[model samples]
Target: MTTLVAIALVSCDGPTDAGAPDAERFEPSLTGSAHVPYSTSETVALLDEHTACTIDTYETKIDCVDSSGATVGRFGDKGEGPGEFLSPARVIRGPDGLIGFSDSSRRRFFVFTREGELVAEVPLHMLSIFVPISFSETTVLGAYTDGVGRAFFSAYMGDVMAAAEISLSTGDVVREWKPASVPEFPECEHGLPYYGFPAVGGAGDDTWVFMGCGPGGDTTMLRAPRYVAESPSDRDVEEYGDGLREFRRRIGADPDVSASVREFSETPRLYFLLRGQETFDGQGRLWISTRRGRMESSFIDVYDGVELVGTVEVRDRMIDFDLFDGTLAVLVERQVGPDDSDGVPDRGIDWYDLGEF
Candidate 1:
């Protein structure tokens, strides 16, 4: 049951104009009081949330936490065995509340029950030369049959950059939509084609997809194409891609908004940037993050379908976030200097109570 939101396209303005309109502007409903750090026996990986599970990664092991922020006894350890994750890159909580993790190093999709039990590990070599799974928390992972499903954005060869869905029940590839029809991206000329995690909207009946990408170190936020329009002529897709690039440039340049384009290259042929990541409340609002520096200096915005509802300042350093049943959980790190671990800003688990908002 994949539903794509039909958005009415609008010319994007720079961030100076991206603020809340005077009429509907309400004080930021987000309030945060940090909790004591969960004493991790070891360091954790990036944080991902879903309806039933929240996952964090270590170098090779993954910790599964329940909604209460309590660690589940079952953890994912990577190895050659079945259900093992080898270099798991992303862990997403799906729309059906199922959990999905991509093992880029191993080239497989590990599907787990809410209880952290392994169910299936599907491979996506045909639809995607490699599947870089992002946004593992949404239901779209299995619901998309249109072949527009995508997971990650990376310039690295063998890194699954583009993906479309086959089915939710059985991990199958949609053969109809072959070699994903990505819009014209001029900025991806660098060795690494950058992409962000997937943001899904219009859940059950009306749904749409939005992804932001960029060159590393650039604070630009290029959005995905508006899929609800009439059949795009040859030029439409090109123009659409260009418009998104410009929109990203605009928002990245704004001072009130904490966004930037990052440029870190893993290989000589390419550079990298943090693509925009998202947290969608069960309803219409969305919380997106783009990075300016190494620290998680992120800005928050609320969106209903294509309309920007409100924007606010998220006062802390964060790397990733997840939302489910109206609860918003963020992953923050205490970044220490290169030489010393003592100064790493103490990281905590923070959840936003947004049911009424």
Candidate 2:
């Protein structure tokens, strides 16, 4: 059985005073603790008041840690069997004390109990990437995409690529909704070929969809009509492309500076600034992290539904985060040492109290 739900349109023009207040500063109460030595980990989720879950991308497993930073138990391995994962992309905790794991490589969804017991395994088709927005004993709601495609870079910017409601018992998609047509910009040569999909987060019965490309590339909580403003003049785009090439060269990513510059120059002005990850707090506030500039920390935008609440700045680069019980669990990259040989930097999970906010 399949059903389609019309995408609900909401206002995106929030109040002018939505910026973070000067008096409000969110400092990490705990920093760089040697307890959780990060490796190829990308995400952190708070399971309970004292328990934190960290996903190890390299190990392909999830680590459960207590408040004292002690490893309580570990679940998952690299396999095709139950409780195993091939490419674990996202891990989310459900309201019923079940942990949902979306494995893009295997194209399957695995559910586990809080105590690390394998409960359910469902094979998913169509969507290559899955981010669970809401889950129950029988149903799972989330936003998904068929990976990167030209249609994803449409100009409308308001449409979600795809969304679904899956049945846990039958491993079937009970409902699916997709955009009718993706608007395109014929003049712009650059199409978002990478992961340019919108960010989706949900709490309780509410789900929040955040499109990456808005006016000025600012993060917007609701999907509004595509901005039809004038594209950056060709000369301006070229200048900005040159700057981007230089930055890439300095970072040692682009060795052929000339080719990089040419590539960027031919591309369209997709976004003024890149938006990062987003998560919904326990109190139903949507927190989105947007990069200020190259190699800069993230400014988190808080929203109550489509209304802008305020912003919070984090000093470190936020890879991914999770919120539980009014606590913000942030996974941040550790600073590299001069003597560090390996290119991969260590990561740590920092906790912040969002109770007062």
Q: Would you estimate the TM-scores of all the predictions?
A: 0.56, 0.67
Off by over 4 Å in 1: 1-59, 66-69, 95-97, 127-163, 167-170, 174-199, 203-276, 292-297, 335-341
In model 1, how large is the Cα lDDT of residue 9?
19
| Range of the 10 consecutive residues with the lowest summed lDDT in candidate 2 | 2-11
267-336 in candidate 1: lDDT tens per residue? 1221111332454665756555433222434344555655566543344555456565655666655444
> Total backbone clashes of model 2?
0
Alpha carbon RMSD to native, model 1: 12.2
Error of 2 at 267 (Å): 8.4
Error of 1 at 207 (Å): 7.1
lDDT (tens digit, per residue) of candidate 2 on 1-357: 222221232223322232323324454444323245554445566776566777765576777776666776677779987768877655777766567877766878888876678888888866456666657889877776555322222322223446677998887889866543332212222333212233344433222243432232223324322212224444435444544554455346654556645554554434213222566665666665543321235456566665555666654656666677766676666555675688545566666666577
